[model samples]
Target: MMTANPYSFRKVALGDLDLLMAWQSSPHVQKWWGAQEPYTAADLADPRVARWIVSYDARPFGFMQDYSVHGWENHHFAHLPKGARGIDQFIGDPDMIGVGHGPAFIRTRLQALFDAGAPVIATDPHPDNAQAIAAYKKLGFEPSGPAQETRWGLILPMLLRP
Candidate 1:
């Protein structure tokens, strides 16, 4: 059996912008996530999504965001059942990679979503991101459909049902 997750999550704030930018520039993140402009105050204030900074042992090392699948018009995950949520995340600290933190924290977050009444959780990772695909599989996410190109990029849609 798995032990309890050691990660904690808090909302991303303006002060985290620099850290987020640095992480996005890391080769590991950049390879799979691509470079992203730092989030602005307006972006964080967007009601459609909730962004978070994930920590372990009180040290911040990752970022995550979740949003309503149907919040945006023409969203790739719009076909999911009502009340489904979509999540995107990455481990920022290179030292934290390959230590099982990804799956542990993700499972913790998914449990929270289920406890809050989210019937399904959706994710769309780029088809070439084998590491991410494998982690999601270990967490019980299964391919919901074939790969498709969307505004976000080419993704293999996956979902987990509680």
Candidate 2:
């Protein structure tokens, strides 16, 4: 279970909030991450967010959110169709960048999602976020070939299972 190959997701704690926020707001991360409005401590305090801690090799490495489960539609990915799960994640720990865990981590989660009955998994990111776009492509995510000229509308499709 501690192996990097079979990634497991864990619930996050209040103690991890600050570290998570720091990563969310960091300039280094802004490129790969979406520009969500600053999440107040009170926001993180929300129980509905259902945050999770991401690990690789038994080491806690980053964070992930399940917005497709719930949230405001226009802003976050809550607009994703029912039965679709939206995921937002990051390598919160500074030392973990470029460690080569992201693609596999996403792959594992997508597999888990598909196994759970999600027929389609969608991700929306800034079109200019080249590295992330590249990474997703490498993982078999293909564009729906639609763009809205906004950060969204850049739809990437993932075949969760079968």
Candidate 3:
């Protein structure tokens, strides 16, 4: 039988801004994440967003953020149920980018959300981000529908019901 992933998550704090900024601007993360502008303190402090630092074997390696779908302004998923949430993430460590770590981290994060009463979790990745789409699918996410336009850009909506 498959074993549970051991990734751990820590609540992001202001001190992490510099680290977040570095990852946000890194070529590996930026290529797919499209960090148009530096993330501001206000953005990290948004009440609607829950940001976390993802670590493996006690080593920080990535970042993840989730928001209440129904609480976000002009959110395409505003129609979802109250417990619905949306997540965005990326592995910042180039050495850890690819090696079957993404799906595990995502699955672990989803489990935490589900345990916290979120029945559904959603993500929107740029249509061209096939690798991200595939990784999300491996975590049991399915395309919710056609592409949608958002302030960030065009993305294919995917959702997972836990």
- Output the lDDT of residue 112, model 2: 76
TM-score to native of every candidate shown: 0.96, 0.73, 0.92
lDDT per residue, candidate 1, 7-115, as tens digits?
8999999999999999999999999888797799999999889999999978999999999999999998888788899999999999999999999999999999999
lDDT of 1 at 118: 96
Instruction: Itemize residue pairs with steric clashes in candidate 1.
Output: none
Per-residue accuracy of model 2 over 79-119 as CA lDDT, tens digit each: 55567666667777778778677787877777877888876
lDDT of 3 by residue, 101-158 (tens): 8888888889889999997999999988999999998888999999989887898999
Q: Cα RMSD for candidate 1?
A: 1.8
lDDT (C-alpha) at residue 133 in model 1:
99
Better of 1 and 2 by lDDT: 1
Candidate rank order under lDDT: 1, 3, 2
Model 2, CA-based lDDT: 0.66
Error of 1 at 160 (Å): 0.1
What are the RMSDs of all candidates, in order?
1.8, 3.9, 2.0
Q: Quickly count the clashes in candidate 3.
A: 0
